[model samples]
Target: MRLANRVRELRARFRLSQHELAEQIEVSRQTIALIERGDYSPSVVIALKMAQLFKEPVEMIFYLEEEQQ
Candidate 1:
């Protein structure tokens, strides 16, 4: 299974740039970019941080995607 997220959508909703979000979350801009592109899976702490920052639940921001059979 892979993790999927709505980081890009939510970030846009809040009108925050990747750099801005990264600073708010205390991560690198590249990390935010990777998460948005689904290239990297965030840790639980990171997910929670994102959830808190966006005022959203972690489940709403991230979910498990079953692999194709």
Candidate 2:
């Protein structure tokens, strides 16, 4: 399974720069970049806060893709 997130889309939709989003989410800009590039995954608590801040369902923001690696 591959972990993916719609962070870029949401950030654009919200007109938020990576730094801005990171501020709102209480994380570092690099962390946001990492998440956006699919290099790292946020924990459940952080994910929940991110979804709540954007008023989106967690599933809509993050998902698991099934594929053989």
Candidate 3:
């Protein structure tokens, strides 16, 4: 399974920069960039923090994609 997210979209909707979101979540901007690029999967704690900040459900922000078999 692959992890996917709508971090960029949500961040834009909230008028937040990557740095701003990272600060709110206590992560580095690079981490936010990685997450936005789908190059990294956040820990549960971080994911929860982001969901709360965006006022979105965790499933709405992050989800797993089943690989086609």
Candidate 4:
């Protein structure tokens, strides 16, 4: 399984820069980059907060995708 997120799309939809989004979420810019790149999986609380901030459902923001064999 892979942790996939539409963070870039949500950020763009909110007209928020990476730095600004990171600040709002209380995380580092590199953390945001990691999340965007699927290198990191946020905790459930953080994921819920992000979904709330974007006014979207959690499923819309993050999901688990099957990895290629």
Alpha-carbon TM-score of each model against the true structure: 0.92, 0.92, 0.92, 0.91
Query: What would the per-residue lDDT of candidate 2 be over residues 35-67, giving only the tens digit for each residue?
Result: 999999999987998899889999999999986
In the predicted model 3, the residue pairs found to clash are none
| lDDT (Cα, tens digit) per residue for candidate 1, span 1-69 | 988899999999999999999999999999999998899998989999999999999999999899788
- The lDDT ranking, best first, is 3, 1, 2, 4
Judged by whole-model lDDT over C-alpha atoms, candidate 3 comes out at: 0.95
Superposed on all Cα atoms, model 2 deviates from the true structure by an RMSD in Å of 1.3
lDDT (Cα) of model 2: 0.93
Report the C-alpha lDDT of model 4 over 1-69, residue by residue, as the tens digit: 888999999999899998999999898999888899888999988798899899999999998899989
Task: Give me the candidate number with maximum lDDT.
Answer: 3
Q: Which ten residues in a row have the lowest lDDT in candidate 2?
A: 60-69
Please, what is the whole-model Cα lDDT of each candidate in the order they appear? 0.95, 0.93, 0.95, 0.91
Total backbone collisions for each predicted model: 0, 0, 0, 0
Cα-based RMSD of the predictions, in order?
1.2, 1.3, 1.6, 1.0
lDDT of model 1 at residue 25?
93
State how far residue 21 of model 3 sits from its true place (Å).
Answer: 0.5
| Sliding window of 10 residues with minimal summed lDDT for model 1 | 60-69
For model 3, residues 1-69, the per-residue Cα lDDT tens digits are 999999999999999999999999999999999999999999999999998999999999999888679
